[model samples]
Target: MKTQSVAIVLHDLRGGGAEKMMVRLANALAEQNTAVTMVLLTEGGVNKAELSSAVKLVELGSPRTLSSVPRLAAYLREAQPDRILSALTHVNVAAALACAMTGMLRRLVVSERNTYSLDKKVNTGAVMKFTYWLAPRIYRRLPNPVIAVSGGVARDLVETESLRPKDIVVAPNPVLTAKVLTMMDEPASHPWLQDPATRVVVAVGRLSHQKGFDTLIRAFAQVADIPNLRLVIFGEGELREELSALVSQLQLTERVDLPGYAANPLAEMKAADLFVLSSRFEGSPNVLVEAMATGVPVLATNCPSGPDEILDQGRLAPLVPVDNVNAMAQALRQCMEQPSDNAELKNRADRYRDALSAQAYSAVLNGSVTVWGR
Candidate 1:
């Protein structure tokens, strides 16, 4: 077969779940001998270094998604890629409009990375709210396949966005990769990892309200009686000071560590005994799959869209309600006391290996399979 050209449209190379997944997918597709190009709306971002050398990077020069539409249309007219995959709502809307403006026939696949209706609770800015409100109208009119990271997210699209059920495809995020597995063995310099007597519980994500770090801190304080136990949260966001204040007020400052962001978090997760994801809601949590891939016992809040599906209906790991301090504390206590089967956790994580996801997406791009209706 002739080499197929693929382009991934993204807002930027930010340190978010969607950006990270797009980079991994671009790399994976390039490795498969598929010509991969990343069309970024903005300039340099934190994960810009993570892009594979084989993949081409196209910077649109526009600082905003809406402003980038003309640039995107120009690129589509010039490159005429075999397929285009866009991530998140704002960029997806831009991609759809760009394609309409350019009249390109390339297969366009837009992905939803979060439950937008739920995300409004954390970020209800006028622009974001209006964008999401207008998304369904644009998405419904566009003749493109939509990829939802989880079943819950797909349902949200249909129920909230009024999208057709047959138009959305449920594709979990690709997380487990050779690089990630190798990174797990890399040495971590954290004291909690170095101290053999220290029992560590780790959570990785932005330090924002959506991540529910405040709830995690309260839950950790409730379990302060568990000696030698430590809570470490990785990632940076707007709520760092608020979370820090809560930790200090609870008098658990010494026991909890908020080390901001780590470029290689898998190594730290591998060293920890337990992993927790306290998100208010998620599309498909990459951290959940990453923690499980490291053979670490995971305790995720049974948030909409990802945890229940990723955890095999709570068989792979313990699940708690979102923002429930008491439930999280109870689950944390029981999990700390038990021995989790590493092999089983690894098996669960295997379902989300990058190779499988890349192959599925490639098939979608190739139009060999219909990726709709659940």
Candidate 2:
């Protein structure tokens, strides 16, 4: 075990749920005395700063997934990692190819962070479609079980991607790590959070069709008349103009605001009254867990993958139908009117502790364990 080293491959530490968890996982693995290296196709993202000093960062300096395969193989040949973990679909495919090129397929583990069916809906590029098409083929050929962030993602791999049940391992994202829980205690920078009189409804995600911010904005308009109510969506993406236009179209500009990328959404969540996840689909919905960890009331769209499991089938928090404006609106009103049990929320969030997530990954990489995130 002392001689073992793990290499985590991904497309830079971007501002995405999977990216955030991978960073936390790398940091946690380093803390456990495992030699860890983060191999990036590109070397920069907002989350890069969150990586621990102990974890080495390597840049392939390639533009995208397929182009980085040779560089990744070169890194593998030089570093000779005992195990490789890759996240996100494109990166997973690329890593598998790289591992295969280096004769290290048995040492590689691939993960699907979001529900692929939904991912396909949002990212419809011909190349992206081809990559998703290539994923199952590449993933199924690997010797190690594919790590999935949620049961839904696991199922999608089996159903949509044609992976065998024996090829799957469910692992929750490292959302409520001690570092993150501590970050939740940091001071809130948003002024809306400071006003106790204002009932703030916060949703954190990229402003893409997958996040369903347009649906959330429309839902917020339904309850906009509620005094002191305000909605703030955090994170940046390609659909900013479309979402902003919809917000204005609904005449919700006064009540709704799309504040771009938040370096520390948990801190803002700590101060907000409610946190909503309106994703069209998810693997584990890390933001939901983070909000619950902050003890903030949360509402989610009952999407294909993570929400039902994360919310314990709506026992932990309320879940609405995906893209149903009326149901989401009503849920929003009910959540805000009804104070949540902060203790219960935080306790539920603790199940995905960084230590536990890291332990599962470590075991998988060690080829000693199979199932997790139950």
Candidate 3:
């Protein structure tokens, strides 16, 4: 029998959770003796460190264009991997279309990482909306399977869209607990980690409206009266200037720190006293799972998809309403006053261990399962 090969496609391999998940999956598949290759649509934003040596990195060397699609389709068709898993919605849609155009339909999995509706805001204008509206129809016609990162994401796709429930699979983001533990065990070299007294409240995500760092800033400011508490947001995006302005306007210049994309966020998550997810919406947040793995008590805005589901409907951690500064402040205060048992939280998180998630993905990718969502 010929050795099986799989290609994981993404727009870029920058520091987002979805990108990290792709890297993890690539590494895991490679370790299983599957010939794994990672194809990045853009070259400049690749995070070289996150990927393993076993996995091959193929960069298209530029952003995708109408001209590039045929070239990309040709490349994949020529490679003819046994399976192709595309991460992120836009990339997934593109990969599916490209594969269809090229007539390479062995196994194509489209992973939806965020809540479907937020794509509208992420890409404004009528053209973007039209594309989004057309995406479901286009996706439906493809021979590929759809994978939702969370059950909520799967539900949204099937219930709200024209997609068949049977075609959408929910494979929750895998938690690389061992890797996270190793990173956490290492000494803190970052200047922010040097101080023992600094009460670091960390939020990990791209600096976007969806992640709701602005609301986190507002909540942090309200509780700024608490001495030694510092807010650090990891990850980068277009909202850098806006978030900076908000931090300055709140007069939290001394307290708020925007680290701007830490390649290994688990290090920061482990060192922090608290982890927060203030997203306006999410599909399944890998950061929340990672924080839980680090035994850090998490406080998240009860956003769609990931947080509530990961937190087990607020039984594990505090869930505040989205953009509510007062409620968020109160939640933070409560967390400070009464800390959850780190050991218990870590134990709960261990259930979603990387090995289990890898097995689930392996089963799906290997054609052992038909459907994967609730």
Give the number of the best model, judged by lDDT. 2
Clashing pairs in 3: none
Instruction: Give the TM-score of each candidate.
Output: 0.95, 0.95, 0.89
Instruction: Assess each prediction's global lDDT (C-alpha) against the native.
Output: 0.85, 0.86, 0.78
Per residue, candidate 3 scores C-alpha lDDT tens digits across 160-265 of 7768977777775766646777886655445666688777789888887788999899999989888888888988888999999999999999999997867567
Per-residue lDDT over 1-374 for candidate 1, one digit per residue giving the tens place of the 0 to 100 score? 34389889999998778898999889988888899999998777888998999999999879798889999999899999988899988898888888888776346878889986786555578877878877788777766567888888888889887899877777657798788889999877688977989999999988887889999999989898998999999888889899989989999889999998786899899899899999998888889889888888889999987889888789877899999999999999999998467789898788788887888777666655555223
Model 1, runs deviating above 4 Å: 1-3, 370-374
Worst lDDT window (10 residues) for model 2? 365-374
**Model 2: residues with Cα > 4 Å off, grouped in runs:** 1-3
Backbone clash total for model 1 is: 0
User: What TM value does model 1 have?
Assistant: 0.95
Model 3, runs deviating above 4 Å:
1-3, 62-66, 125-127, 189-193, 370-374
